[model samples]
Structure formats: structure tokens, C-alpha cells
Target: MRRWTPFVLLMPFQFIFGLIYSWGTISPAIHVQSGWPQATLDLAFSLTPLGLLPAVILAGRALHRLAPKTLLAWALTCFTVGGGIGLLTASPVAFMLGYSLLALGVGAGLSTAACIALVSRLYPQRRGSLGGALLALYGMSSVISAPLFDEINRLIGWRPSLAALLAVYAAVGWLAWAFLPEAPAAPGRQTAPLPLMVLLRQRPLRWALVIVLMATPLGSASFATIGHLTKAIGVSSALGVLAVSLMALGNGVGRLGFGLLADWISPRFSRAAALGLNALAALLLLGVLHGYGVWAFVAYPLLIGLAFGGMAGKLPALAAHVAEHHGEAAFGLLFGAFAFASFLGPFLSAGLGMHSALQGLALCALAAMGLGLAVAR
Candidate 1:
């Protein structure tokens, strides 16, 4: 078990991301099929982040009630069952309810508690790279699932495509139940008081919050808007979808590649570099609005995916550094607080009037980049 710890640690995240996160790509399709105008569809897509607010606030205590393995198993079952419900009905409202339920389970179960807790303790030196690698694996599921879901739709239909997704979730759950390790409870507040105000008073935490607020909106907006940008820039819908596929692939690559890169460079450097890339990515995205032809399709998502990946890869290391520096006793509380920022990413992106949000996104990314460098120094 010790020899296989890393693999076991990462399995739960891979499953959760594969099911819920991948749906961003499918969101437009859901919108079109459900007859909800693009506005409603976008709103529904952003709900996961809204719902995550309360869920992340309470997640540490929720994980304490059961072993991480038990909690993960139950979470995966909820995800599978919710996905199965999605298959049973075609009503857009029904689909929204089903996906939201899955998203809720994902938010609670996939918190920093399990993987971060386990790996940071077991392999403290490698936590950054390991966490990044795990996130990358999560990204891979999106890459693979995007095209697979498309192919599944082509062959069986969306309903069965969802049913198939349920099977995958179930299989991953069983693997988690069978293999994920149970860590000995570390010294900390077993029931840490949620310090909503502590974060407000702490300068370091406030800085971390600013980073997430910036990067997450950048990460999510790029994801949400890439399809629209492609079409508006004159790529056909077919090509827009193709660009989305590449974006997903790039997201995974960013995670894995940058995770490894973080191992080599200082976490501070890794973060600053990520912020810089995000600024560049934002410019590329803004350029697309000017009609860059097929080149825009290739350039924008690639840059966005890379910057988004950099942010994802750097987070675990950043969080772990704060935890170790402040006192591991309060790690869960600190991590949960940091996660609250992740919960805001999608809403920030969508808040930009659906038409010109990219400009706002670029501005936000630049602000985040500047903050990251300051915080690192």
C-alpha cells in the first residue's frame, strides 16, 4: 500500500473531475437541446461554483464524519446516480438538477482534505509535483471525455452517453473504496471552527484569496468563452468544437507539465510565470475578437489552456507552502479558506456581460498576475 500510495491518493480526484468538470464542453449542446437561450444555459453552468460556496465552507467537517475513502465512495455513488438521472430525462431543468447534484458531491468530496492531506504528509517534498500531476490526470479525463462523449452521442445518443458515464463513475468508486488509504488523523482541530473573519484579518490569506479570484475567473472564463470566441471569429461550429477539444487537451498538458515544472522551479517563480502566461493568454483571446481567422482558433485556447494549467498546477504547492509555514495544525482550515476562492472562478467570468466578458477577463488576469508577483516577493 505504501508503494502504491500516490496512485491511490490521486484516484478520487480523477473520477470526480472526469464526470463533472468535463461538462463545460457539453454545456452549449445542453443549452441548444434544452431550448433554453444561451443566457440560461450559461447561468446553469455557473451554478456549480455558486453551489460550491456553502459546500466548501462545510467540507472539512463533512470529511471528518467519515474516512476519506468512505466519503469518496459515497460521493462517487451520488455522482453516478445523478448522472444516471440525467440519462432518464431530456428536460433541460431535469438535466440541470441532476448535474448540480453531481457538482455538489464533487465539491464536498474532492476538497483538499483527502489528497492534499495524504500526500503533503507522506511526501512533503514532492507535494507540488504530485498534486499537479493528479490535477493533470483530472484534466486528462476532460480531454479524453470530450471527444468520447461526442462519439458516444454519435453512436448511441446523449441519454445513453450519460448512462455510460455512470458506469465509468461506478468503476472509479469501486477502485477508490478498494484502494485509497486512510490517513491517521493529524494533530489539528478535528472540528476546526470556521474562521470566516480570520481570513479577513490575515494578510497572507487575503493575498491568496486575491490570486484565486484572479486566476479562477481567468481559468473558467477562457473555458466558458472559447467556443463562442471561435465561432464569432469565423471558425465554423465544427471547428469551434474542435478548438474546444484542443483546449481540454491543453488544460491537461498544462497541469501535468507545469506540475513537473514546479518541482524544478521555486513555487514563487512557478506562480509568477503562470500569471505572466495568463496575461499573454488574455491578449491572445482579445485578439480573436478582431478576426484572426483559423489562427485565432489555434492561438486563443492554447494560450488560455496553458495559463489555466499553470494556475492549477501552482495551487497545491502554494497552499501546501502556506500550510507548512503557518502550522500544519491549521492546514485544513487554511486550505478550505483558499478553496473558497476556487468557488468564485466561474461566476467572475460569467459576470462579464456575455458579449464582452473577455475584456474583463483579460483585465482580471492581468491584475492577478501583478498580485501573484507581489505576493511571491
Candidate 2:
């Protein structure tokens, strides 16, 4: 039980923060209830990653100055307050602000950088597998939350259901706070931190940046507008929500599965394979756009979700591998850089129509695969 404390305590927080991925479900409801344009609702989703970038940097720095538990407490408070605001107000601006506030809390408290840093300290040798497991739960959050929220919306209404969801998140956050351990202290003779400019100049980090930029856009587009895309393709709205849930399921499985593969084989092989998966997903999306048939409705989401999860699971391990001597601080910086690049997808998707967005995603995936293969060599 003591050995498992980190996993037990942290998993819940990851799940709660993971709810951010369920924006596909939430955005559609907002569109239906408020009659907001799809693009405008997508802007709300895009704001999350934009907001997260700065908060992650702040949290990474604060980890040295404050207790992890304290940061997490603040995260919970922000998320709950944001949700409460969303519940009380119907204004789109207020909703975007509320979600942005939630993004800040997630970045500052329950972020991947913070979690990976802590877990790496605890299980340095198994960081790849452990990071995969942690993020697998993160990907799965949408799988569980989206349909649950959709049902709640059906039974009551979107606003009330949101309040209930936030209430549960608050309870879970408190539980995680009570149980999560303080991060272990650093070694007495620590190496000096690398300058950001120097770190960015390294070969592997550059490749990691390219990979993140290429892979994230498709997943971002799907996550932001899967429900709308499904409906546009003639699927029922409920089924559209279900497709998002299934996509999330695939995302979780891919994370867990691909993370284990990285541990078993090599990070390079695992990443290349994941990029291949992304390329395949992109090709399928092209077929879907051409009216490939009903199978695409099921297939595209699962494949893209898998590719997305694979990228998320593998990238940290890749960073750790490339910067083994620099330690977790360096890993945090690398991950932060990757996170900044990842925001492009949702922002791009927000402006483009669905068909054009899919075309762009295919091009992005193909380009990523070509670059990834070259980098692997």
C-alpha cells in the first residue's frame, strides 16, 4: 500500500484533469443550448491549451518553492470555481473564461510535467512504463467523463450536470490532496540547470518538437469537434458523443500499450511506430471525407485516438532518454516546449470547416511521418 501511494493518489487527479479532453461532448451541448457557432465554441476549447502553457511553466517553477499538495489544492479550487461560474452563467464569454480558469488550475496543479517529474524521481528506471500508465488514465478520463456528462445533460440539463461534475471533481481533488506524497528531495550535488536556448539547440529535442507539432493537430481537431464532425457525416448527436467516448477509450489503450512497448523495445522504435499509426489514421480520415462509408464513423476516431495517445505516452520517455544527464528539470522544460507546440491543432481547427480541417490533418500526419522517419535515422 505504501509503495503504491503515488499511483493511487495521483490517478484520481489525472482522471479529473483528463476531463479536459471531453470538450467534444461539452462543446456540442453548448452549441445546442446557446446557439453559438461551432468555431466560437472551438475557441473556448482552444483557450484551454493556450491558458495551460503559462500555467505549466509556473507550476514547474513553483514545485521547487511549494508543496505539491498545496499546488494541487489551488488547482482544485480554481477548477471548482470555474465550473461553478459556467453553471451559473449562460454567456459564452463567461463560459470561455470559466474553462480558461479551469485550464490554469490543471496546468498549475495536475499537469503532466509535474506528474512526470515526481514519478521519475520515484521510479527512475521505469519512467517510461509508469508515465504511460499515468497518462493512459488521463486519456481515459474523456472515455469515462464524456458519456457520463452526456447522460447527465439528458437527464437534467447541461448546467446542472456540470455543477454535479464539478462537485465530484472537488471531492476527488480533496481526497488526492490528503493522500499524495511530497516529492522526494533533490541530490546534494546537483548538476547545473541547462539554459533553455542550449537545450532547444540539441538534436533530440528538436525532433521532439517537430513530432509534437505534426502529430498534435489531428488529435486536437478531433477532440475539439468530434461530435460536430460525426453529426456532419450523418450520425445522430448521441452517437457522436458516443464516438468521442470511444475515441478516448482508444487513446487510453494506446497510451498504456505503446508505453509498455517503449519499455520493452526502444523509444525510437515505439515513436516511429506511433507516427506510422498517425499516418494511417490520417489516410482513414481522408477516406471518411470522401464518404468511405459508415465504418469510418467507427474507425477514424479509434485510430486517431490511438495515435494521439501513443504520441503523448512516448514523448516524455523520449525527452528523458535524450536528456538523461540533465534530470527531471530538463524533462520539464522539454515537455513544456512540446506543450506549447501542441496548441496549434485546436486553434487551426477552430477556424477551418470540418472537411478542410481533415485535409490539413492528413497533410500534417504525412509530413510528421516523413520527418519522424528521417530523424530516426
Candidate 3:
């Protein structure tokens, strides 16, 4: 039981950090209530990734010297302050700043790269399984937070509901920080940290980046646009929230399931399989665009969630596999590059329009499948 304490403690932070995924549900609500233009609302979500990119790059580099607890403290502070600002301010610029700050906090502290690096160091022998479990909670975060936020919004209002969320995040983040054990020192001859330029120059790392660039949009599109897509399909607002919840559920399962699969088989096979799922999800979305029934709504998000979760679960492992020599420091830079691509997915999707976005996702998956196969060679 004591041995399990670290992982158990890590779960809530992962869950809270995952509220980023709940943006699909939250964005639509804000738009409906505030009458903000779609572009402005979309920008709020986009700023998260934009903020995350630099913070993650820095956190990845800094983790070698700083403890996870230190970084997590920073993350908690940013998240709380950002949310507090959002709670107080109604101005679009102010809200964007608040959301961007939250994203920066997420990138700097609670990122998947940080979580994977910390846990893998603690449980070196079980890196794949442990990484997956932690990330699964992260993926599942949306499932729990989205519905809870929706209910809170229904009861009070979006602003107060957001405040309630920040309060919970603060409490949980503190507990996780207090309980998290120090990351064990690297066991073998530690290689010097690779420069970002050198890491990017490697052939396999470049391929991994390509795979991320292609696959991330498929998942992010569903995350950012699902509520609108559900309504477009003539579903009720209540059902739209349900679709977001279901996507998150699928996201959690995919993270756990694919993480374990990568451990059991190989990261390469797991990635290929995930991309295949993404391809199928893209097709499903196409069907929906062509006037498929409610079932298309149901099936589309589940598959995309799985693909997204699996991709998120596997990519870190794949980067580690490709750059094993550089160790955790390198993992941060590699994963940070992938995060940049992940950001582009939703940002572009909002601008491109839904049907075109889905079509673009299909093409990306197909392209990634070829890239995955080539990398395997």
C-alpha cells in the first residue's frame, strides 16, 4: 500500500490538469452565455497550447535541476491565479490572459512529460505501465470535470463554477505536492543533456514529430469542437455535454489500454494501431458530415478519444525509445516539440471549418500511418 502511495497521490493533479480537455464543453457554454464571437472563444482555447509550448520546453530542461514538487508548486500557483482572474474578469482580453496563464502553469508544472519523467524515474522497471496509468487519469480528467462543471454552471453560473473548480484544484494540487516522493536519481551513467537542436536533428525524432503533428489534430478537433458538432447534428444541449463526457471516457480508456499494450507488445505497434484508429475516426466524422445518424456522434468521439489517448500515451514512450541515450532531459524537449504540433490541431480546426477539418484529419492520419510504417523500418 505504501508503495502505491506516489501513484495514488499523483492521480488528482493529473485529473485537474486534464480539465484542459474539457474546453470543448466549457467553450460553448461561455459563448452561449457571454455572446462572445466564435473566434474570440476559440482563441481562449488556442492560448493554452501557445502558452504550454514554451513553458514545457523550459520545464523539460529545468527538471534536471529542480524537483517535481518545485515545478508542481509553480503549476498550482499559476493555475489558481489564472482561474481567479477568469472568475473576476469579464473582458475578453483579461479572460485570454487568465486562460493563457493557466496553460502556462499546465505546461510548466503538470505536463505529461513532467509526470512521465518523474514516475518513470521512481519505477524504472515499470515505466510503460506506470506512465500509462498516470496519463489515463489525466485523460479521464475531462470525463469527471466536464460534467461536474456543466452541472455547476447550470446551478450557479459559469464564473462561480470556474471558481469552484479552482478551489478544488488548489486543494488537490497541494496534497499531491506534499505526498509526491523525490524522483530517484538516474541509475546508470547519465548522459549529458542533449541540446534541442541536436535532438531535433535525429531522423527518428523528426519522424516522431511528424507522427505527432498529424495525429494530434484528429483528437484535438473532437475536443475543441464536439459540442458544436453535436448541435449541428440536431442533438440537444444536454446530449452535447454527454458527447464531451463520452469522448473523455474513451480518452481515459485509450490511455490505460494503449499504455499497457505498448508495455506488452512494442511502442511501434501500439502507435501504428493508434493511427489506424485515428484514420477510422476521421472516416466516422466524414460520415457524420454526410448526414449519418446520432450513432455517428457517439462512435466518432469514442474512436477519436481512444486514438488521442493512445497517441498521447505512446508518443512519450516512443520519444524515449528513440532517444534513450539522452534520458529524461531529452524526453522533455522531444515531447515539447510534439506539444507544439498538438496545439496546431485545434487552432487550425477552428479556422478551417468542421467538415474541412474532419477531411483534413483523415488525410493526416493516412499520412501518419505511412510515416509510422516508414519509421518502423
Best by lDDT: 3
105-159: candidate 1 lDDT, tens digit per residue = 3443344445655665566677678877776776666656777777776777566
Clashing pairs for model 1 are none
lDDT per residue (tens digit) for residues 1-377 in model 3: 89878877777777777787677678888888888899887677777766776676777666666666677778777877777676687888877887554633354334555677777777766676778788788767776788899999999878788778868877887877887887775534244456778877887767777778777777877776787778778877888877776777777888787877777887777788888888788777777778865676667777888888888777556656776655565556555655676676776776798768867877788788778877783
TM-score of each: 0.80, 0.84, 0.87
Off by over 4 Å in 1: 5-9, 24-40, 61-66, 84-91, 103-112, 187-194, 234-242, 286-298, 325-355
Candidate 1 residue 113 Cα shift, in angstroms, is 4.0
Ranking by lDDT: 3, 2, 1
List all candidate RMSDs to the true structure: 4.0, 3.5, 3.1
Give the true-structure RMSD of model 2: 3.5
* lDDT of model 1, residue 146: 72
lDDT of 1: 0.61
TM-score of 2: 0.84
* Deviation from native of the Cα of residue 134 in model 3, angstroms: 1.8
Better of 1 and 2 by TM-score: 2
State which candidate, 2 or 3, has the greater lDDT. Answer: 3
